[model samples]
Target: MISNIMTMVRKELIDAARDKRSVMAGLYYAIGTPLMMCGMFMLLIGQMTSPEDLNIKIENSDNAPDLVKYLSSKGITHGDSQSTNDKGDQLDVKDIRLVISDDYAAQMAKGLSAEITLIADNSNEKLQKSIRRLERNLQTYSAEMGSLRLIARGIDPRVVQPIKVNVEDEATADSKGGVILGVATMTMIYAVFISGMNLAIDTSAGERERNSLALLLSHPVSTRNIVLAKVFSVTVFAMIGLLLTLIMSKISYAFVPWQELGFTVTISTEFILLMLLIGLPIALMAASLQLFVSFMAKSFKEAQSYLTLVLIVPMMLSMAASYNIAPDTLQWLPVSGQQQALIAFIKGREIPMLQLLLSSVTTLIIAIGLTLGMEKSLKSEKIVFGL
Candidate 1:
């Protein structure tokens, strides 16, 4: 049986390798996704991070000298549209207008409400971080003045600030980058599913349509051997794709400036090996599941449609785990459990052995069950001949 299965596996692998389209499809995803993700992260980090020296137009500087000084201390200095830096480079001056009321300083003497109007295009996405920074600083200065007025009247500032919450972070530096890790893990896991989908359909429904499956089955090999061979071949392809993705991610992620985001994401060699070890069972499950669905379909296009929809289940499971939707329940589920385990491992936390073992066992069981179902279905005339 093992000999027959190995022969069939060799045949399937050779055929898949000959199909240039399927081979390139897997390679593109393995190589392209990590690079694309890195670009997206860089763009987001740039937009979200506030500039070191925010230059905005400051109106009525004489009316509130103290306020101007406070803003300057916070890196919010005054600049016009034509302002240039010392290196002769054009300064990125935001189109923000600060209109201070003429009675600004007088209101401070009487401890009355001072009016300052900030004008700018708040709808602009590029100005969002700068605007928020300005608003935050203005609010801080206002609070300081209010506290000083209360102190003059022999009042305690603590009386107004009844609830002061001090947050003490216990998460390690590695754990703080969980969000980035989660996304990276999700992409890698999905690669296992997507990388072999086309080939799985081609081997099952495509071969059946071309009458090659009937020819292969007419030989002395048992249905069990054929099913096992197909599963092994697809799983091999999936694993190779996953390995490529991990390698690309490990190399490309090093180029990203993670320190600017206040945390680092180092895809260590240990992580790559562990990810490959854990991805094996998932690759098996993905192979068996796709083969089962492909066998159920009448044609290659139908199988493609079915697998596309069916694969969404695993995608959702991985998504839930990535974003931390239901940690308690999903921690016990299959795809999500494995992902959560990987995440915990990357976060420098101890791996949950029990959950990982249970989830892995379940995944293997699912793959075995699907393989058995495919073996049985191959015996039916209607399944083989599409009658």
Candidate 2:
């Protein structure tokens, strides 16, 4: 029985390998997605990191020469209309303007409040961080000036405060990159579904379309053996694709500027081993699910369409885990559960062993059930003939 199933598995793999469409579908995703993600992270890190110099428009500079000097000391200064950095690169200038009131220095001399207007589009997300930095500096300068005045008057500057608050952050660098790691891990989880999809559909519906399924089913092997063989073949393809994706991710992720985010996704050797360990059952479930769906379709195109809709369930589960939309329940679900575990591992946290075990058990159960259903369905002439 084992020899017969191995023979069937070898044949299915060889046939699938010959199908360029099946091979390329897995290759493209396994190779392309990680590189694409690296490029996106590079762009994102550049945008997120603060530049060495911040340049904005400062109106009525003479009215607040002292204030302008204070801002310059903080690396916030006015810029030329066509400003360039030391490297002659064009500066990323926020369109923020600071307008000093005409009587700004006079108010300070009279021991009264001074006024300045911050002008910028508050709705612009790109400018929000810069604008807030500028506001914080201004507030700090104002508080310093007030404290100096109180000290000169023989009064304690602490008189203005009724409460003192000190905040201590306990977040590790890995914790800061949780969102990015979650997204990265989600892509790896999805490889299981995508890498084997084409082969699964082709082996089932494609076989029927070519009028070969009936002939193959007529052999002496049991339907259960045939189902197992097919599932194993598809799973081999899925695992291969997943491993390729992980390798690509491990290499490509090294180039990303994760330090700017105060954390990194190293794709450690241990994590790779864990992913492969956890990904096996997912690959099996994915293979069975795809084959089961494809076998129900009358033709290759119909199977593709059905699988598209069917694959969404796993994708949604993975997405929920990635975005942390439903962690409580998804921790025990198949794709999402494994995703959360990988994310936890990346964040330098302990593995959720119970959830991982439950999800793995559930995954194997689904694969077995689907394989059995395919076995039963293959025995029905109406289904075998697509009647």
Candidate 3:
């Protein structure tokens, strides 16, 4: 049985290699999609880091000279209160303003709140973060001022605040690596499945539609051997596509400005090895699933539709995994389990060896069951008749 499967695998590899269109389709999907996604993400990162200037308005200017000076020192220019027309048409300022009321100190002393309006172009995303930062800084400054006022009354500033707190993180480098690895793993999984779709369909349903599968099955090899060969061929193409995508991702990361993002993305040797170790079995399972679906399909178009559904499973699993849903009873679910295991590895958490073993076994069991079913179908006259 092993020798027969190996022979079939060799035949499938040769046939797949000879098919230029399948090769091209796999290359385009894996390599093209990642590059496009990376470009869009890099553009978003660029927009996030760019400096933003805002326009603001202060209502009462008389009592907030210190606040106004602070805003000016921060390079934020403010607008005058009288700039509004009778129709309430306010002249737009390029930045925010600090308004000080006559009873500002008294209002604060009584624990009453006064409102300050921030007016700026909200359309710019970068400017929004800047506005938020300014607001937080102002809040901190006000707290400090209140503390100084208490000290003047011979009260220790610490007396008013009963507790002080600080945060310490215990995350290791591997765990940090895991966060990034998770996304990459998900992306690679999607790419591999998508890239192999055409090859799997063409090898099975395409051959059936073209009236070629019947002739191939009539060869000396058993129907199971034929199915194994086709699946092996599809897996090889998928693996190649995945490897290309992995290489391209590393190359793209090298060009990205990590320092500006405040985190370095070093694709370590362990990450690459772990990705391969985890990704290989998943790819095999994907290839097997596609081949089974394609074999069950009546025509190339039908296979295409079925393959679309198959491809969606991984993406949906990935989306679910992103919500940090714990591995409960649902985690044992096929694609979901694989997603969780990959995520665990990516997060630099110690992957439960049991989960990995179980996922691999489950995928293989499903693949073997499908292969057996396909083998049975192949022996039928309806399959040979291309019905």
Quantify all predictions' global Cα lDDT against the true fold.
0.90, 0.91, 0.70
Off by over 4 Å in 1: 44-57, 75-96, 109-111, 119-133, 150-172, 261-263
Candidate 2 lDDT over residue span 124-157, tens digit each:
9988989999999999899889989999899998
Q: Pick the candidate with the highest TM-score.
A: 2
Estimate, for each residue in 1-387, the C-alpha lDDT of model 1 and write its tens digit. Answer: 899889888988999999987798789999999999888777766654655799998888899999999999999989887888899888888888999989988997778998999999989999898899999999989989888988989999889879987999786555556667788899999889978887899999999999999999999989999999999999999999999999999999888888777776678889989988889999999999999999999999999899989999999999988888988999888999999999988777899999998998999999999999999999999999998
Full candidate order by lDDT, most accurate first: 2, 1, 3
Off by over 4 Å in 3: 1-15, 18-21, 40-65, 69-138, 157-179, 259-264, 328-351, 384-386
For TM-score, candidate 2 versus 3, the one ahead is: 2
Residue 97 accuracy (lDDT) in model 2: 94
Kindly provide the TM-score of model 3 when superposed on the true structure, using C-alpha atoms: 0.74
Winner by lDDT: 2
- Residue 178 displacement in candidate 2 (angstroms): 1.1
Clashes of 1: 0
* Candidate 2 weakest ten by summed lDDT: 171-180
TM values, all candidates: 0.88, 0.90, 0.74
- Local lDDT at 309 for model 2: 98
RMSD (Å) of each candidate, 1 decimal: 3.1, 2.5, 6.3
Please report how far candidate 3 places residue 127 from its true position, in Å.
10
